[model samples]
Target: MTLEEQKEIQQLKQWLMQSQHQAVISGCNDILRRTREDMRVSQHILKEVLYLKAVAYRLLADVNSAIETLNELISYFPDYARAFQELGYCYLASDRKRAAHSFYQATRFNPALLTAWLQLEKMYKADNQSQALALCQQQIAFLTSLPRALLGATDLMHEGQLHKAEQVCRQFLASNEHHPEAMMLLAEIGIQLKVYSDAEFLLESCVTLYPDNDRAAAAYQNLLSKLGKFPDAVSVAKKRLQYAPESFTVKVGLAHALVGVGELEQAIDIYRELLSENEDRPAVWVALGHALKAKGDTREAVNAYERAIVFADDFGDAYWSLANTKTYRFSDELLAKMILLVDAEATKLDDEIHICFALGKGFEDSADPTRAFAYYERGNRRKKRTLQFDIAKTEKALQAQQQAFTKGCFNKTQGCQAADPIFIVGLPRAGSTLLEQILASHSQVDGTMELHDILGIASSLSHQATPYPLNVSALSNETLSKLGEQYLRQTRAYRQGAPFFIDKMPNNFIHIGLIKKILPNAKIIDARRNPMDCCFSGFKQLFGEGQEFSYSLNDIGRYYNAYEKLMDHWHSVLPGEILTVQHEEVLDDLEAQVKRILAFCGLTFEEACLAFHKTKRVIKTPSSEQVRQPIYKTGMGQWKPFESYLDELKDVLPARS
Candidate 1:
């Protein structure tokens, strides 16, 4: 409060941050001794010195030394709440969760110590439990007891009960304007809830108040990146890098921004550098793989993916990445290893979707569709979409796309290169894996498992500055043609020189428009299954990949609905461009349906398509294991298995559509 005291504080900060850390430590010790001898040493002064020591040790990564310092500080003054909080973190650094919790609770009685609860929240999150109410309650509850309503409301914002938190924030701000912390909290929460405009506003307001906080810089950068403002994200990352160049998280964010701006080489270089610095970090390796894959280095990308998993096991991401890279030797050995992993963990684990799905792909690649189908069914059962709705909509889309496609009244000529992959869309447990096997058996067709490649492109494009279909008028026909040409070029690597390549990505049903503009000649296949089964199947499966929407029942149902609506809209706009297939119909008359599909593709009906059951092709979808055997007459109209659990999804399903 006084000039002299402020001067002393400034001098202390400088002394603590001097060029020589040992010199700074010695200076701090001398100051403390002098202050104590003069009877001028305060509890605050002691705490500050201890805090500096703890921080220095932490920076050096001497966890034991940090713990000792923090422990000594707490023992010297057990009544100081911050001491307990810091000591708790030290305990946590040493993996003594219970001890850390004890100290955190001790600090709870002294509400000024925010780190106590914040660290507790981190501990909970690392263990993977949601704890908004428990950890975030500190600052909000503290502010609520104070005179500043704005600060109180702001505290609640980051605790994550968003709507209520915002109401508190607005109400507080209405009484007294320009409360910076409150505004920052509101902005931070807005970003979390995907309200970009509000977040930008609050973040801007916070910057005007506290311009030097690295945390604020990172937060703003993240918000900008998510909003598809890559340039802005890059700018902020540069500022943060200036402040903390060795910050790995910040480097990762910067790398992501570079990648977004199509600076593949630069991003790759940055990631490779970061990987070298943090050699064992899985994320750096993962990012390297992403960059390499985007740049079209499939083999190196696969190696990077494998290295990532090797460094960090239990990472389901590597499996998904490996499957997508398609660089490894697809052999029985890979499948057996995956199977062993799953089998070894079967008794200990309640779910095996990760292992089962990956192993199933191996079997499918081996042309053991029967075995592939079994694994797929196993994984799908874990997913819960059992054939009902998958079969129904699959049939409906099949008929609709087929009829429209047969009309063949296009205004333009058919000279453009189109993606003619057969897609099997529906809920996971739907008979898509079986359908893929049958279709892949055709001589002219190459059946790859459900590749989410097209969907990834569409999703990534949606995150672009000018999202397609959103600003359709902004795109000229030439641009559209260019986009299509680019799509063809990108997929050329996977062309396999086949007349048709099956793009069995189920989610492609959601992006039929992007598919149409790029590949006017591409065939869209919509696979449908029962709603109850679909949702149930989704709930049971553990994807650990891009199906972020599949983790919850409602999210999965809503996602399916969105996909269906989009498919229907695409069909209306581009009649005869898509082909829909029903799992049930295919099962009933495999030869007839296969013959009709072949005819549509301009190929004569091959008896091999009829004997698709006898064809041995790798069936890589979750249905891989199931399709290896003969077509089963069962699995159609089977809602009994999930009837009790289908209540939440009953209205979500299409009724007789």
Candidate 2:
């Protein structure tokens, strides 16, 4: 804790890092002897000392002493990935099987452990474990030849120290320019930071610099898919598959690309083929379930999820996949198992979060509101720890938008004449997907996934010092028009020659001014719901990605308030350009609402729109199953049962609209 002690510890750490075993041992022993005389040394520093001592012992070929030191350190810091990795090294030097298990734990805790992964690959190869061998090889291919310095970055990344990891990766890349591994690692960190443009650039560079590197190419293709550049992703995927004809990982990448391109059937077929070839792969089953669920085949999707559970019962994703259906009823046995697994000590954090959400859904359906709310709250709390949302920062950003996007902002630029896009924007779990389903049922509209083009554009503009809408206000009419054209070109992959297409990105509500400036003729539908219902619905639901605000009631309420204020601003400034549709109103009179929605989109009324439940199109949101059934008010007041526990939300949210 003292400056002198800290300096001494750093020196020892440097020596250990440089593999000076004798020096590390002597320095650590001197520190330990001094610490015994002075009780000022904290447990935190002591743990690090023990860890370094274990490393020194391992380097000195003292396996037993290394194991003893590691055991002592792990008793207090059981989740220490590096300690487990050291234990793995020591065990591998003594007992091969134990070493494999230790390495497995190392990778389980910190998936970015390239050394552990490579060691496991060798162990699995020796044991003739083909499936694990393939998985390990796939992981190795992700960063085939990691430079020594980048390993520290990867470790930091796996431990969720992304900013630190980014710093280290950038430092490495500064000297080792175009190093594919460092680029891929930094790109991954960029993805986690929501800096998609930078991530895309790095990935693109990685792929171009190493075209034969399957992993870098796959990472690039995956980034393209994440950005909703499915056509481009498909091109890249096809090229990668052409080179690695027998690689399952490449095939899976192609399946993801197909799904993104709205080729659900093709994606499903590919997933099925992959499963047939590797029947025990739980991930393949989950992927198949996703495609089936998106394609609106509820029964088959449930079957696929069940198969995933059967293959790997403790797999949390499979349970979450089933619960995400919103209509899947958990049998007593399954429910009990989920309850047990949710609290299991061995369950990984991500797995536990999924299991907790699934249990919440199960209890909700069983009419156990108290139990359901408890599980939901627990799951939300767990997820909130991972999010970096800041309410004050969000408020500041929202205020900047209001100040920048005055009525005059839109008057400066004449938007493109493309009336092809029908935009559904609102808060998540507020019926945007349902609106998309209704519109997609109409003959002229093509229902697309929550297209990322608009958001992507906003993110690119978000890099300015002023941030977001303030930065967007500087764009010229020509630039706006070009952006609009680029959006249409990017989204063309999801259109099937339909005159209009639906892009139901809920968060686009914040960018209404930018939307009008780029595509003034585009239809905008604001999906509004009751404040409590919308916020609580979002709180209970687990999104596959984004919506970080939904992980906590206070954050959700603050976001909803911001969203409401922005919607009011958009309506006042751009009247007749945005239509507001209340969820309850849709449920109250489905036919009338359908007519109104169709009329607003400048399309004729059709009876098919009234029967959107039977439209037979792909649905990907949490509301997928609910939207497949006839309109009902069952979801209307479900929030009341849990209202007593929602004071944090009530304190921030405006009254029901």
Best by TM-score: 2
Residue 307, model 2, lDDT: 94
Tens-digit lDDT track of model 1 for 1-657: 246545655665675576345654565666567667865555546666776667666555666887777767754543445545555655664556654555555444354345565666566666765664455565546544554554445434432246777888778778757666666667776765545566776776666567777667777787666554566677788877887888888888889877654467888898888877767888778778777765556578788988987886555556655654433445566566567666552211222555555555556556565665466556644443211123334345334433333223332333245556555665566666666666677778877545544544444444457653354334556765676665555444444577777766665665555555556677656666665555655554455334655544555666676656656666676767666776677878877888767766677777776666566543333443345557776555444444444544565664721
Per-candidate TM equals 0.44, 0.83
> How far does residue 470 in candidate 2 sit from its true spot (Å)?
1.5
Cα RMSD for candidate 1?
18.2
**RMSD (Cα, Å) of model 2:** 6.0
Give the alpha-carbon lDDT of every model: 0.59, 0.85
Tens digits of per-residue lDDT for model 2, 360-462: 9999899898999899998888787656567778877777778888876676237577999999999998999889999999888999888889989988887
Error of 1 at 202 (Å): 25
- Span of ten consecutive residues with least summed lDDT in model 1: 385-394
> Over all chains combined, what TM-score does candidate 1 have?
0.44
lDDT of 2 at 166: 94
